[model samples]
Target: MHRRALLAALLCASVPAVALAVPAPPRRVVSLGGSVTEIVYDLGQGGRLVGDDLSSLYPEAATRLPRVGYYRAAPVEGILALRPDLVLASENAGPPQALERLASLGLTVRRVSDAPSVDSLYRRVEQVAEVLGVPQAGETLAARLRAEIDTARAIPAPRHRALLLVNRSGQFQAAGRDTAANALLGLAGQDNALAAQRGYKPLSAEGLAALAPEMIVITSASLQAVGGMAALRASPGVADTPAARAGRIVPMDDLLALGLGPRLALAIRELKKAAQ
Candidate 1:
């Protein structure tokens, strides 16, 4: 036989005939954020979720999952014990050291960015779906959410200006442009009085007085901390504000309003009602 033919025959014999190897799917998944957990369940991968952060309270079933501690202060040992093949977390998840430890353990950790707007919220869903190998499911959910948001936006703009306040430990925090509150306000066809600002920041008494929003929207969880609507109105800084003077303060569930998950449609509806 010719040398070239002999070489070809040798190569053919050396390469064994076999089926291509298929990559194994992640069997055990750990979700480290409330929104992440919600998305995983929404994607129909709830059964794969072996562990979840304490904040993953929605969907009822998530509560029964193994608790992995708080989003930011997750216990590395507990996460490792779950033997998760994949870890889905929010961008803000961790004290840095904990995330590093998890990464060092060869865990596949993916961080989904927090969505502060309707568009960004859809993007977040898409991101989660991609990580879970369910891009179609993500697209379907995003489309549905977009339709609801469109319906909400179709409502006529409210006559009143609304201010969204994020109350934390009795301090007043204002959500500005590019925030979830601002997006919800837009969807509800209401103006964000603080739209000119960049992000959530502490508002000084003078700053509150200057804005004088027509309506005040606060997180329900902080109602007690801020002494409720009447007390918020009586605050020295906001006392003279239009929202305070008119007694138009509205309190909403923090998780629903801020989660930026499937409940965004509901959040928009409630905001629209509040605007009216």
Candidate 2:
């Protein structure tokens, strides 16, 4: 009898206690990225969003939200003044110290990954939904995004190769393999001639010549800064490229091209048309 009692005690001790899962239902949330803000709105939880970054300019309604400043340059005082219960931010959002200070203030800060691929983008949506207590909404959004992406992928591949450039000042950078631009280009059935490098980086005139891309894509903001496509093509090093030769340089809005939000599907569609 004593032996049985001992065995029962040991068994009870060995069995781990099941901890209850805590539900995350933040009443007042602040978003620190344009993409994050869009996700919050898509999830039908826009009412919960108390503030947003300056770049959260889509949905037209989002612009009416209280501004929390730019993501990278967020003002700590402005954020603190909002007294947000939870802060949803992109991984790229911040001065590290500002994030630390918010945490120290007993605020729940969730840093979301900046997913660059389609799969990763879905995962990000799911993550945000989970945080917002609306996983079903995320699944719905992911399905729609997947279907749209599939349609884009079904388009005929462009015969001409293209180079995607992100210009800063006079320095020119090209997107390489495994980048967000490369992934989008692949979905659009366009060949990224500069697929050897892993990410965007400065390339020399000789490097551009070696890649011999048939077309060029520049952000409209950069094009304006560089005195438009005509001036870009007139540059000593860029004038000889195949893109210039064929007059296939295309300028698109930077936010439309780089912002990985609900509107990315639209951007992909526009890119497909541009490639043709």
Candidate 3:
């Protein structure tokens, strides 16, 4: 068994029941993560979204909301200008001080978990629902998602070694353990090619060749960044890989694959198909 399988087993076995928070529902809300925005929309509280951070581009409506800068670099001025009473942020959001400033200014900032695991995904939905003052809706949505996920997990996908690549400054960074891509691949029954490592890291050409991924997954955004499939396949190490020779490169939605949002089941299914 690979490292990711053991990690997944541990993660699934160890996840505790998430505790939901209780807070008054706000009339105006700003969401800082794509997953959080999707959860808010799933909870039937789309009308409350007055603003969102740069990364909350999902469900069509979230893209129309006023932008408050990138999630990691939250701009207090941009958020305050929206006059939102509640802010739903991913745990990865902000430089810390921005969140503190918002809280200090009497804004209700609810930090939703952004851990790239199944339990954390569920926790995010419940957190958003609780903040929206609708625990029942959260429960209902979570149950449906759980059912969908269980069905996807039972699909019996091939146990191929898979690599999810993201382009960063012209270098290809392979997704490793603790990444959203890693968690999704494991759930989809694919072995993470870089499971021995943690986080995305730029790989040397020899390093990429050695991992020997059977399938290569890249987000649409990353594909465009790296100048499309031909260019990607022609990249130094990839050209010598079995995946490249077999033409098993797949491009998918970044939000679904990496955001670990409401479409996690779909992401799993897509990955399972990619593994074949």
Candidate 4:
């Protein structure tokens, strides 16, 4: 075969054709991302959700729905068990094989981008709304979100140095650039203390003091893991930081602090308040 033709054939062979199609308004839908689920509820069309991935917990009602598995590693069998007519996945969904299995088996899977940004969030809301057969609601929600985001951005940020941490198995992981936490801090006009690096990294006991952050942020779940504010303040090197010494450690709602979704403006406002 010609070189160009060979390359083209190889590309086609390597990529799977997974098309998403819904002939009518879907009566049963499975949401794979928290942001997607949030948009569905915000669009006032939560009644169509038959099941959700583990990451879809929000709005209180989402927790009560049957869960397939975590969005990032959803199980094919688990998703199949729900008998959904449409599966709306976020950009972070699946172990690749599971999603491919679903698609190859004829499940209509629509993937929405969950990139951390106001524009992306607005697009996500619109995408979810589109998939749910509520384009008007999606447009309205997107416009409202855009206006609220603009209003939030209009407020000058305090520009305080902030450090966000995730506690995993008793170990502290610092949020760096490209993370949801860092994005929120940036939008709120705060500097990410660990922005010198990309993605979450383990911080040494001595590192926090040297960074000298004005505020230390953590998720509510992480706070619970380390036994709350007192425990976090007592952790190694934590007390040495100006934030800890000044009692500036604050834990925010897990989803609100970490997920980019319909409540982004609210999160930004809360982050701004935390810096003060």
Clashes of each: 0, 0, 0, 0
Task: Supply the TM-score for candidate 1.
Answer: 0.81
TM-score of each: 0.81, 0.80, 0.89, 0.89
* lDDT at 121, model 4: 86
RMSD of each: 4.1, 6.2, 14.3, 10.1
Q: lDDT of candidate 2 vs native?
A: 0.80
Tell me how far the alpha carbon of residue 88 in candidate 3 is from the true structure, in angstroms, after superposition: 0.8
lDDT of 2 by residue, 7-88 (tens): 9999887665432345448989999988888888888999998899887877778889899889988888899888899999
Q: Candidates 2 and 4: which is better by lDDT?
A: 4
For 1-276, candidate 4 gives per-residue lDDT tens digits of 699999999888766543333267888999988888888899999999989876676899999999987899898998899998899988888788888899999999999978867678888888888888889999999999888977886786567788999888778889999888888888888888999999989887888778888889898889999898887899887888888877778788878888878888888877777666
Candidate 3 lands at a TM-score of 0.89
Model 4 residue-pair collision total: 0
lDDT of 3 by residue, 1-276 (tens): 699899998887655533234344599998998889989998999999999877776889889888888899999999999999988899999889999999999998889889989999888888888878899999999999999999999997678889998887878899999999999889989889999999998988999999888888898889999788899899889988889998988898888878988999998898788767
At residue 236, give the lDDT of candidate 2.
59
